[model samples]
Target: MEEKRQTALVTGASSGIGRETAIKLAGKGFQVIAAARRMERLEELARQVQGILPRRVDLSDIEDREKFCQYLSDLPEPVSVLVNNAGYSIRGAIEDVSLNDAKRLFEVNLFGLIRVTQACLPGMRALRFGTIVNISSMAGKFAFPMSGVYAASKYAVEAVSDALRIEVRPFGIRVVAIRPGFIATEFNDVGNEMTGDLLARTDPDYKPVYQASGAGVGKMFVNATVPGPELIADIILEAVMSDAPKTAYSAGFMSKVFLEQRATLDDDAFDRFLTETTGLTDLKV
Candidate 1:
């Protein structure tokens, strides 16, 4: 007998890991719904991935978001998977960052994710089979300077996925969180814009630290050493199809090392790791 075909909704499918994952899933005979704010890009993706439903959705808005969820929930076909991959980052010290910026970050990264999950749960429950995949970051597990708020937001996501996994286990729904270290994408380009006002207030004592951190991020972007986004796409594929997908998936070489070190490092060792990785050793804290 032929295997049953399923339907999947992927957010942030305009580019990066999300786009590749959506395409891969579609290739596997899954009817894919590619959701993102960029309609043109999504349309292009639809052409490349046969049977894809390219829907424009700004997950940041709660009301319009409901419609996207409703689209999947009401599908005559069962909605078997949801990949919550839409998120952005604001690079700056938490205290110096503007409240609005932080709010926007959380609205998209946290609130938007929650809304979609809530909207889809009922449909999944009815079917008694579903997979919810959330894209988190390595930053969620380990802390470093200038990422306090962003890390906090991802930490919340990580926590939510953990608790929800058990809560929904009884209902036959699976929740998996994928934490990527650093796959080059527009994610960093937007993160670089920490607002001029925020930059102007950077502490003179920490100038070297900021400069070093900036250079490290730039090099990481330019070097592109991490495995390509396609690797992540593959991981997502396994997560969705495997009967025993891990609760959390970590990708990239550095990311794996960082996660392992994070599990064993003391405060002093972690501080050293951050300093060496970001070239912040010369900076006065």
Candidate 2:
């Protein structure tokens, strides 16, 4: 007997983990709607994949996002599987990032996810079954030097997922947060572009901070392999298909090490650890 097909909506499906997850879900008998700002890439994906349906929407734009949400609400099948994978980052210290830039990041990363979830919840409630896979990051648990703005967004995502899991359990809706660490993707490149020349724009005091943090980050991958998006995409599929999925799962390079330390360390101890690891301990401007 053929397995019943489910409707899955994957945001940011133009590239990286979102694209891979959409493809994998389609292979497993899902009618996958691939949403992204890049209509060309999404259309390309749809052409290559039998079950894929490409849709374009820029999550950071409030008007466009609201339109997308309304479209989701109107879907006939009601998205039982929603992968809120559309988010990007900007690298900078607290003072370096403009308030507008930070707000834009939140608009896409946190607010967009929340809005999409809201759009999908009604159908899930009606069916009494659904899975929401939120693609968080290791940064969500702990901030990295020069990456505070991005980390803050992910932190909010963690909070939402944590609370929503309990709130929606009675309706059989499962919310799973996936924390990926240092995957090989264009996500970092996008962050660099979005952040502009951080060192150039930042105060003189922050030069050393950025250099030290960069050095520390380089040291982290001396002999390690940075897995591709498939690793997390597979995890998302597992969670989506599972009868009982974990509330959270961490994968990719350095995720275990960093997450475990964050879990075990006290605030002061963790602060020291982060500083030392990020080469910020003796950073004196």
Candidate 3:
């Protein structure tokens, strides 16, 4: 007997985890609606995968998101999976980063995700079975010095997902948060680019600590055998297909390690560990 093909909507599908997840889902017999701000890249992805239907969607734009949702609601088949994966990081000390940048990060990472999920929920509710995979980072669990705003946004995601998971469970909807560690993606490069100006303007007293933390993070990403985004995609696939999926799945080796350490370490110990690891200390400039 041929299995029914489910429709999946993947945001941020132009690159990294979203792109990989869309391809993986399509390969697993899903009709994937790959949505991203980059139409050209989505077009290229469509050509690369048989089941992909490339659609341009900028989640940051309210009108664009509304139109995209309307299109999905009117689809012949209801979307069975929604991957909320569009987000970026702004790496800088909290004091150094502009409030505008922080707000922009939340707009895309938190509010945009909420809006898209809200649009999709009606369809998922009507269908009575769906999975929402939210891409959260290990940073969501622990705040790092240069990435506080990014971590704060992800922490918001975690809280939202937790509440949404409980609220939607009765309707046969499943919510899974995939927390990935240092995956080899363009995220670091983008973060560096976004924070360049802010870092340059940082207070001289805090500059060394910020620079040291950034260097440590850079080395962690470079030297650590961080799995690629495809691993996260695979985990999402598992979460989507399982009859009783876990509410959260840590997707990389380091993610698992950190999560475990978070569980075992006391607040003071963890702070000390972070300070030692990132070279952050109370030093007089």
Instruction: Specify the highest-TM-score model's number.
Output: 2
TM-score of each predicted structure versus truth = 0.90, 0.97, 0.94
**In order, what lDDT does every prediction score?**
0.84, 0.94, 0.87
Judging by lDDT, tell me the better candidate of 1 and 3: 3
Q: What is the model-wide C-alpha lDDT for candidate 1?
A: 0.84
Q: How well is each residue in 1-285 modelled by candidate 3, as lDDT tens digits?
A: 987888999999998999999999999999999998899999998998999999998776778878987888788888889999999998777777789988878988999899889878998999899999999989889988878999999999999999999999999999999899878888878787877876468788877787778666566666467778999999999999999999898877477767877879999998887776676665446
Q: Pick by lDDT: which candidate is best? A: 2
Using lDDT, rank the candidates from best to worst. Answer: 2, 3, 1
| Ranking of models by TM-score | 2, 3, 1
Taking every candidate in turn, the Cα RMSD to the unseen true structure, in Å, is 2.4, 1.2, 1.7
Q: 70 in model 2: Cα distance from truth in Å?
A: 1.2
Off by over 4 Å in 1: 1-4, 193-206, 215-224
**Cα lDDT of model 1 by residue, 1-285, tens digit:** 987678888989999999999999999988888989999999998887796899998877777888877876777876779999998888777667879888888988998889888877888899899999999989888766778788988998999899889999998899999999888677767677644444568777656666778786565556456677898889999989899899999996478778988888987898798777776776666
Error of 1 at 113 (Å): 0.9
